[model samples]
Target chain A: MTDRVIRLQEAPFDYGAECAAFAERAGGAGAVVTFLGLVRNDGGSLTRMEIDHYPGMTEAAIDAIAAEAATRFRLDSLLVLHRTGPMQPGEPIMMVATASRHRAEAFAAAEFLMDYLKSRAPFWKKEHRAEGPIWVAARDADEEALDRWAGGAG
Target chain B: MRVLYFAWVRERIGRPWEDVETTAATPAALADELAAREERYAAAFADRRALRVAVDQRLVDFDAPLEGAREVAFFPPMTGG
Candidate 1:
């Protein structure tokens, strides 16, 4: 069985602490890879970002993705953490960590997790700018990123 | 069944969730039924291409069967990261 840690929270997470803890728990895994996503200010107009999610479905969707990544990569461990609710620009929005015996597997799995989370997870983001709030649209590039993993590109 | 809306859909509908009694056999049928009930529902679901659906908390197509489904959700495409 693959060990997985998944959490969906409204509070901010400490990236450094979470990385250390994940690496420690991964134990004998020779390689660990982590990714962090932060809210960005576009044209310095973004004041804050509001995230909305289906309470139960969001967790289920993320768990399914993490489990798939673990199996595909033969990972020793995996962690996925995402935050919902209002957040300021520059604040950390989410993180994913993967561990495996080889660096290649760890890196690929982390990227895969990110690609799936970006487009598949049941989370919606709205940017509150100086003018008004607007819901962010799903990017076609994200769907293309996910497709690469299926065609042996990743 | 409980019908839930989120993000702009929720904003457009002016509520988060509602219980509906319907004979619709599929999500598309259900959407049509709801759309006929009110202008808000029609507006929220006007563009099918902009919306995504889930049956019983799992994402599914509009043509997905609603048999034994207790919940259905409608929202815009996910923009998570």
Candidate 2:
């Protein structure tokens, strides 16, 4: 079966391995755009970070978003993986790679995927700062990102 | 009537999750039920300004009905990425 999205257990994501996986699927594609999200060290002093999700809801929501991206952008293949639960700094939080016959489609789809993931997915974040763990609120900037994708002058 | 708090909402509420029973048949009613639970719940739900809720796995507004939902979740504006 053709696979477009993959969400898996929290582990050290190997970028080389993941890129190879994309190339394997991109045999007939001319261009590929990949975006990797990592836990920011924020000056290299973070103990750990935690991700909270709504289980079944999170997967379903992500799948739906991928489906939407596939429809909106002409893509040969798409890969998306997100991690949940507790995680330490420098860990791979999520990845999005899109393959297409042209760079425009691949890049647009990758950007679109990240933008949607930021605003639409049901994931929550808590930062483990030196002071203590603090819950971060969703930023208006993310919402504006979506609006820009929708052709608004955000 | 299992109510879940996720992410920062769970933090604000001082828990990872919670389950409660109420006579609420709609999302708004459930919010009311939660708001009336105790000082903590009320404080957690104090400003309904940016709070988002979900019935089952689907995002819905506070006025949405919850007739047959197995889970109801509450959280702040989503920050997923």
Q: Is the docking of candidate 1 incorrect, acceptable, medium or high quality?
A: medium
Each model's C-alpha lDDT? 0.92, 0.80
Q: Write the per-residue lDDT of candidate 1 for residues B17-44, one digit (tens) a residue.
A: 9999999999999999999989999999
Q: Candidate 1, which segments miss by more than 4 Å at Cα?
A: A151-154
Residues B1-81, candidate 2: write the lDDT tens digits.
Answer: 678887656766787666676768787888877778678778888888768888887888888888878888888877767
- Model 2: which docking level applies? medium
- lDDT accuracy of residue B79 in candidate 2: 72
TM-score of each: 0.96, 0.90
Question: Which candidate leads the pack in TM-score?
Answer: 1
Clashing pairs in 1: none
